[model samples]
Target: MKILILGAGQVGSSLAKYLGSDDENDITIIDKDEANLSSLQRHLDIKTVCGHASYPNILEEAGIKEMDMVIAVTKSDEGNMLACQMAHTLYQVDKKVARVRTAEYLHRKELFSDSAIPIDFIITPEGLVTDYIKRVVEEPGAEQVFEFENGLVQLVETRAYAGTPIVGHPIKELHEHLPKIHMRIVSLYRNGKAIPAYGDTVIKDGDRVYFVTKKSSVSKVLKEFRRLDKAYRNIIIAGGGHIGLNLAKHLEKNHRVRIIELDKERVIEIAE
Candidate 1:
């Protein structure tokens, strides 16, 4: 696949390092900074274009027309959107992905729907990280939450707490206890190896269980199993950088977000 990535910052550089090395993929990166392009050139074999990516001519010169995928990760959402729009409408790229920061775009998710434009995916790292933090903070015991298809399907992670009803029971009893629940113990992570759960799989203390189930039945399943607990409300985040700023912006409306940073200038900026 021929992939064109805009921007050469940390995200774009790391992406080039990982995705550019794939033997089956061809990666091309574009940035306005010569220094960033030079640094990326030293480490990767992918093609680099040093120019303002927001311009259509630069994108055309970078061969966006022939690209299999176009990824716009520029700092500015306006720039990213302009580049993506050009790639989609002019170049007719197959897959287009953009990294957006503006909260308005995220809030109006219907704008990013498949039928809207040529964009295939919108990766809001800040929003994703904030959502992740909320899940973990709310369910302190849960290590992860894998939502599929806009929360239609879910894979929830929970640890076996001490004194739980299933602490001394075997995995087989779960089926008998909740016969009506449509859930599955897809796999178990023990000692770093994934083991398939069976009737004889003993539910030992401190054992981690990965449960896959429908989204609507999550609360009921947890309630029936007596594993439901209210998630924590207090959250303390340390930093006020771009990532921190984006996170706090999204969470401040609903969560008590407090940012801590060492930079005096940034501290004052945040305070203002």
Candidate 2:
């Protein structure tokens, strides 16, 4: 597959690295910075084009017509949208993925369609990060939480701490501890290496454990691994940036939330 990526920032560069690693993918990235392009060229087996990504000539120079997929991840939301629009309108690319960070643009769902913006997919980093933090906060013991099967099932990652009920216990004993909860230990990691999660495999302190369970039983099952922390009530967020503001918005209705930002203008904006 031939892929064209716009922007050479962290998101773009990371995407390029991952996609370029695949033997079947021919990845080309575009950015305005010559230094970033040069750096990517040296480190990855992908092509780099330095120019304004939303411009037609630059897209053509990056071989947009031959691209099977176009991913626009520029820092500017307008630029990303325009790049996707141009790819769809000009090249008629099969897939157009764009990172549009502005809540204003994302809220207007009708703007993105075949007769509109024509973006096949939209990636909102702020929204993604906010949802991730929400999951972590909701599950007291989990370091990471992923929902699957329409929220009916969940995959949780947590550290085995000393004094936990499951610490030093064999995996087979989990059922005995939590008789009503249904859960499974998918994988275990110790010292950054995988350890088989067999029935006789014991959980040790500092071990990273991944488990799967029904969403309703997640909290109950987590207690077997570690003591659940008290439910969060009062919360203090240090910044009023997009991620922080979004988090505060989600937590405010249920918890006492306070936001502290250095910039007075941003604080005023957040207050409104």
User: What are the C-alpha RMSDs, in order, of all predicted structures?
Assistant: 3.6, 2.2
Q: Per-residue alpha-carbon lDDT of model 1 for 1-272, expressed as tens digits? A: 99999999888888888998798889999999998898888888988998998788888888888899998999999888878777877878989899987776777867764456457888788777877765555444457877788867778876665566666777777777778888987767666666668878876666677888887766654543346666544557788876788767656766777888999999898889
Each prediction's TM-score versus the true structure? 0.80, 0.90
Candidate 1 positional error at 61, Å: 2.9
Tell me the tens digit of each residue's lDDT in model 2 across 1-272: 99999999999999999999999999999999999999999999998899999999999999999999999999899999988888888788999999988888888999999999999999998998998888888888899999899878999998888898889989999999888788999999999999899999999999999999998898888777788898888889999999999899888888899999999999999989
Q: Pick the lDDT winner.
A: 2
lDDT of each: 0.78, 0.92
lDDT of 2 at 189: 100
Q: lDDT score of model 2?
A: 0.92
Model 1 global lDDT (CA atoms, 0 to 1):
0.78
Residue pairs in collision within model 1: 138-231
Specify the highest-TM-score model's number: 2
